[model samples]
Target: MPALPRARLLVAATAAAVGLGLATPAHAAPETIVREEARTAEVVAEAMALAEQLAERQQTLAVLNRRADARDRALIGYRAVLSRYGYDGDPDTARAVLPLASYDLSAGFGLTGPLWEAEHGGQDFSAYAGEPLVAVADGVVTEVADAGPYGLRTILTLSDGTEVWYCHQTDATVVVGQEVAIADVIGSVGSTGNSTGPHLHLEVRPAAGDPVDPMDWMRAQGLDP
Candidate 1:
């Protein structure tokens, strides 16, 4: 037998078996058969409605999954921005301020140790974790991200070409290319990089020169760290 004709014949046979043997008694009346056919049609219609409802639910779930994926990618991009530095535009004109509100000086610049490698490049302000770390000047944010030995840190380039490094931070509130005023909350004090305790490691580099004593530099700017 031909495949299409064979399959059609099988369908007709199964339909006959269902209508005669499964659905109707041998002596069923014509009116009873008409009522049974109407009931069967209603069942088929209900099944189609249920399938449409299921399809709608699946489509809604697909949309929600796409939204979740977008949110997750956005979060990842935000974190990546926090973990590194990049140059934005030219620096702006801004003066310097103390990096922290109030804190004891735990370490000063040029402190030497075998562990320190060369001289310590920055000043350490001993403050509790979560203490606010502010920008020292109004300038462009050149970097905001994780760094070696400094942990989480941010660097701002002053208008006069001075670079200020604020290290051992817990989080950065700004991104590269952001302009910040003096004392703007840039980050939180932390013990992230190579540190014995929670503190702010501050460095000053005038004209991108070698790291200078931040305390002396701050004093020249009339702000004590």
Candidate 2:
């Protein structure tokens, strides 16, 4: 039994000088003493908060692409085809302004329209039962069908000679020549043709055989429509 003590001989010569690899008191504390200008100012404030959240998501996608390009230029119409009313004399009078059709009738009218009140002689909610139909101007379709109570129809044809009937429709997408643009849906909202409930029996000729008087052309387009 020998003696050792002196703090266990200075703790075994500081663990044999940290097993000969030398540096010890927990490697004397120096991991680059946390500097480099405070880690480059916290990496430039996290790259300026990720460039201000990518400039507020590029200004909310440029205001939702300018409101979907102003509702696709209000369903394809601005000017061209100004109210004719011809019965096929073929004069080529040039005019095609579109965007008229759009009635809520507070929410009445659908199928072939005119519900009681002496057949819409009172003009209640006037139009719409299922409402999707949209192709006011750049058209071509020509005519699609449905039968069974006119449950669907199309008949586009616009280039100035007008004629854009699109009644009832529960689904028609488009067919004939198939050009379509303004409101482009071309079919939806249905009570099907001769309906009693759902609605959208639009009709407007103004030329190539006139029918003119869709609520005085939807109040000449300023639209209470």
Candidate 3:
């Protein structure tokens, strides 16, 4: 009977050991699953951040493309205007040229200042005294005389009957009714009449009417100045 009790104790100890072994593996499985989930979440977060950065870059590129398209359209429109004015022979000479080889823009049209009784009607090209001035387009000399406030001036009439005034000139090279082409030396800069400094005061009058902004007219002719 004592041997039977000892065998019963041995069997009970073996069974208890097996149960502890199974419980250990079950507890460890939950910890392993939590570590895997954390790694997956980290990978997903990194991917989301990279995707947001890519979207922002694409938006910036889209804005740049829009601005490029706008500039291209403006260039095309100005080129068309030049072609309509019969300047389409050579691409190099297709646009109207500047009157002076080197000069600075000093004043603008429609400005309110003490120097004028009314709003200023012309654009001023500031340069040294006796700087050579040239014709801006193909035209005939309409007037070349001394005016009270304009000093000595030269006027050229365009094919469209538009008059371009070259004011504050020391002297004029072209006479009345003489045809002049673009860039022909027409006068020299001065500070005569109601003047301040040596500058060419340029004016544009469409159809011999009131003066308009010469800068705007020059831009419409595909010329920047």
Candidate 4:
């Protein structure tokens, strides 16, 4: 090829490329292509927003699941306490457990002693000093103060509104308004107040009545006392 003809051929090819860039298809319009691209971008934005919303919902469900697990554990603990008191999962026929792990009656409920005002208002369980004294049933500690003849005493109010008195404690482990499970340690045995020796003086009083014989109450709870 000659030099002038080769240069002319290169110019013609470049012009044809430019014309191809400017040409439009017979069926497709420029405005339609632009509109299609805008719609695709909008769809992508909507999908991203929906993904974020799903992630937030999953986080909320995780928190709710944790709370429900904690609530279930608390319910199991409460039911175990009830079962120990001889409740066959029935609220109408629940029995009570003994207050102490082991004991011997040192003095009867009606025994006369130097500190007796009329008669003994409670039973004396002969236990060594510092023996753990527990609540007989599930109850709330209503009082943890010293009474006149019962030193270092603790009063537990039962679920049926019965009040139980634990007297002559060397030390009290519970406070007022504290909830106690069945057989939960509330105090230790000691000869406090007008006691003759180291023993636990227990009293049971109904919600609307005076102190009853603790021996009979213990018997009712299937305990020999």
Candidate 5:
């Protein structure tokens, strides 16, 4: 009989260790290992099915990312083109896959427009009063801490590599790794840290930790400061 392929031989041996009794290579008949190959094939097939399932999930994520990019463009009014990799231009406005609601999102509270504001890569915003706050997007609560002028803050990281930080909060809504939704309350606005008054301080950060102008993003969603 032809010799067994080295790859198949290794797989059969491992399968035997996991289930069937393993035999020494000194066994007389090559048929002994060939029988084990069929069992190993079943394992490989199961792995393929699992991979297919993961691929489908990736496709869903791609759609969501596309929508996010469109939302960004609308808010900032920038004609910046985006790759179709993660956009899903869903037109439904009923509820956001992740959304933000009224919770004292006031204006005049940053560097550019407000009396006091924070800086990110040379960008600024208006400063204003801080108060009760909540989640702006659906995601896991990744951070809850203080940033001198920003006050108590909570960061919610969405599945699509977008991070939302609710700053100038009086208190935090959730701890690290906690799952939160767009409709759920997370915290309140306050001047606990480095803030001046009681207004919500919001920032949108990339997964790599770069902060962008959330003003442009919020406007894209048709929200006013």
Candidate 6:
């Protein structure tokens, strides 16, 4: 190569220096680097705070769900108890119900049995001793006393002036004037009067008069024995 002119050589050297300056990156100042780091830290802190809030909300929702489940279980248990007594939610639409949950028809009314002096005046329901006895219909307790052969008895007068007698009970739970709804537990079954095993002697009387067939009366009230 031939030697270049001085002015041209100087101009070429200046152009090369300018190109090197454009290609290489400049070093950042210490204060600028620190500011960039602080900005990054701020962004990270905001993300962490949002994550914590979401976790707390999730925990709160879980607790609420647990409480709702517990309440549902309690309601189911309460409904089960009511169903056992034949209460179908609305009491006004319900007619009559069975006096006991489980029982078998034994000696019926007008049947001649050796356990009775004359013909049987009431229907007999064979059941276990100490079984809960419920009211057959809505009525007010008119009498609670012990008779000669009827044992511990309770007389409930219905709304239509019909009287129902619950005999052979272990004890009476109502007073003389307490109102009772259908399926209300009035007493328990027992052999209190005449000689017999655990049973209930149910009697029906119109206007508190002569005894009648309890099975037929219950059927009239839209219930089977």
Instruction: Name the best candidate (by TM-score).
Output: 6
lDDT of 2 by residue, 1-225 (tens): 011123432443444444544432443346543453355445445544554453344334434543554575567443311221111122242223323244454432232444433233112223444334456556688777764344466778777776767665555656888787644556544554345555565666766475555556555643335
Q: What tens-digit string does per-residue lDDT give for candidate 4 at 1-225?
A: 001123332333344444445333446678976775465455545544554453344334434543553465477774554453334355445557767755777777777767687788888888866666667888999998867567778899999999999887766778899999775667667665666677888999999368899889878876655
List residue ranges in candidate 1 displaced over 4 A. 1-94
Model 5: runs farther than 4 Å from truth?
A: 1-131, 222-225
> How many backbone collisions does model 5 have?
46
Span of ten consecutive residues with least summed lDDT in model 3: 1-10
TM-score for all predictions?
A: 0.57, 0.23, 0.59, 0.58, 0.46, 0.62
Kindly give the stretch of ten consecutive residues in candidate 4 with the minimal lDDT sum.
Answer: 1-10
**Model 3, span 1-225: residue lDDT tens:** 001123332333344444444223444577775775465455545544554453344334434543553465477764443443334456456536677756889989999899987899899989866666777888999998876588778899988999999897766668999999776667667665577777889999999999999888988986666
For each predicted model, how many residue pairs clash, with residues at least 3 apart or on different chains? 4, 18, 0, 0, 46, 0
- The candidate maximizing lDDT is 6
lDDT of each: 0.66, 0.48, 0.69, 0.67, 0.49, 0.69
The sequence of per-residue lDDT tens digits that candidate 6 reaches over residues 1-225 is 011123432333344444444222347677766775565455445544554453344334434543553465477763443455544555557777777767888988998867889989989999865667778888999988876578778899999998999887665668889999877777767666563577899999998899999989877866656
After superposing candidate 2, which stretches have Cα over 4 Å from the reference? 1-135, 147-152, 155-165, 168-175, 178-192, 196-224
Comparison by lDDT, 2 against 5, better one: 5
RMSD of each: 25.4, 29.6, 33.9, 34.4, 20.8, 37.6
TM-score of model 4 vs. true structure: 0.58
Worst 10 residues of 2 by lDDT: 80-89
Which 10 consecutive residues of model 1 have the lowest summed lDDT?
Answer: 81-90
lDDT of 3 at 64: 52
Backbone clash tally (model 2): 18
Task: Evaluate model 2: give its lDDT.
Answer: 0.48
TM-score, candidate number 2: 0.23
Q: TM-score of predicted model 3?
A: 0.59
